[model samples]
Target: MAKTKNPTLYLTELDVTRLEGIASRAGTAELDEMLDALLERAAIVTPDQIPKDVITMNSRVICALEGDAEPREWTLAYPDDADLAAGKLSVLSPIGQALLGARAGKTVDYRLPNGTAQRVTIVEIVFQPEASGQFTL
Candidate 1:
């Protein structure tokens, strides 16, 4: 049997440049490595070149997580803007990392706080800033 290939990760040039700076000052090897892994594999492109379906920074998406009966809306945000109550997920978070470059209908794997694996299905991309021409946000 052929092994399944994961979806390609796409990142805007702007986001990648900024992420590089963040990774440098992450203060922990784990966090730095996580960001590095994502960056290394991503196909970086200009903001206008990114597909609308791709999740960029500040994109709002509806997610259906395994074991959760109701789908929830989450906006991927930087750490400063993260608010679990409002569903503003931080990119530094494990789940957020999983969803970063995944497209709608893709099921992504992330580690739960307890260190167990969990899957999150991206049900829909409600809004992507770059898709709507709101680049640089």
Candidate 2:
């Protein structure tokens, strides 16, 4: 295995269980590849590390279509449920993976279906529910 900075998986309990369900439904190898890649790249950002308004894990992500108006907001989920929702997407998905731990008003580059690349700016982030009261990083 290649060396990486953050090795521990940082998924929520719900995420873990959801991934298990996906593995059962679709098999482990596929999901394993995604998990491996995510773990290798994820920075494991704490609340303090995140910027003032960034959208992060468990935040609602609003995505604007490239050409059309009317941005769509989605409740980011893990594994396949996210895989199914239109605006909501799997953290393993290209854009979702990029948006993880990102704060609001930040822009990120990610690949699209046609092999084209695009930059997206974060407009809003509704923080994780647990982050409301506990202000510790």
Of the candidates shown, which would achieve the greatest TM-score relative to the real structure? 1
lDDT by candidate, in order shown = 0.85, 0.57
Off by over 4 Å in 1: 1-7
lDDT of 1 by residue, 19-126 (tens): 777777767898778887886667777899888888888999999989999999999988879998999999989999998877888898989779999999999999
Q: Give the TM-score of candidate 1.
A: 0.90
* Clashing residue pairs for model 2: 53-104, 54-103, 54-104, 55-103, 55-104
User: In lDDT terms, how accurate is model 1?
Assistant: 0.85
Candidate 1 residue 118 Cα shift, in angstroms, is 0.3
TM-score of each: 0.90, 0.58
List candidate 2 stretches off by more than 4 Å. Answer: 1-37, 45-54, 83-87, 133-137
Show the lowest summed lDDT stretch of 10 residues, model 1.
1-10
Error of 1 at 22 (Å): 1.9
